[model samples]
Target: MPAVVETYQKIKDLRDKDKHEKQKDYQSAVETFEEQAGALYEKLREKEQAVEQFNDTLSHGSVQAHAFVQHRQYIEHLDSALDDLQPSVQQARLKMEHARHVLTDAYVEVKKYEKLIDMKEEEHMQWMKHEEHRHMDELSMNQYMKFFNR
Candidate 1:
């Protein structure tokens, strides 16, 4: 194969590898979304349970001091967890968005690379023809040199 053809093939192979890495990162973003959403959902459930338990204790006409104390602590925990989750959810959303963008860009890049490879292959064919012409000229030169020597 000509040098140009070889270089084009090598470039195409590297593009494939890059595409694979992007896909892996996109997969990881999906997993992160799942993890963030799952944890947030569980925390919301805990918050609801805390509020209900606290209301029930009050309605019974007794302080239930120990239960109230524990419920209050749980409420605080739920609030704090929710606060932390907000920023992480936003970050995950951005990561997913960027991953999607990269995937789209990769698709476009594949087309561009295909065009480039085709062009390079055609140019290589032209180069091969030139090389063949040079080789024939060398053969004639060798014959002339032999005649002169004789």
Candidate 2:
């Protein structure tokens, strides 16, 4: 029983380590997703600022045909860039979700191992108590026989 308990303790330790590693992986995934989202937001902001600047310039005077064409092209380009970024952002979010699920599984596994260890320890304690009671009974019997024979 002791050996079995020791083996279970080792397994519990390994599970704990695995849980920590999974937690780290989930945290890294979260950070990566945040960074990607931040970058995409910054890019969109820059594009908006550029559009605002172009509109300001246009308002200051009569717009030339070439400037109108340039503005249309920039808008088209911004639209395409946003379209491209949307998929990447979605992919990052999915990865973060997957990492979260994996972390949850790892945590459950660690808890299961911990529960097993607790049960085994409880069993071991009960066995020890039973053995101690048996020893006391034997000592009492020996003393009784000694007194009777004397």
Candidate 1 lDDT by residue in tens digits, 1-150: 666667777877788778888889998998998799888889998899879877887888888678778878879988999999988988997998899799778767766878888887788788888999999999999999999999
TM-score, each model? 0.62, 0.83
Q: Per-residue lDDT tens digits of candidate 2, residues 3-89? A: 888898898889889889989989998998898898789779978998898889878988889988988898888878888888888
Report the lDDT of model 1 for residue 126.
89
Q: How well does candidate 2 match the true structure in TM-score terms?
A: 0.83
Give the deviation of candidate 1 from the true structure as CA RMSD.
Answer: 7.6
Worst 10 residues of 2 by lDDT: 78-87
Candidate 1 stretches greater than 4 Å from native = 1-9, 56-66, 115-150
Candidate 2, residue 82: Cα displacement in angstroms equals 1.3
- In order, the Cα lDDT scores of the candidates are 0.85, 0.89
Clashes of each: 0, 0
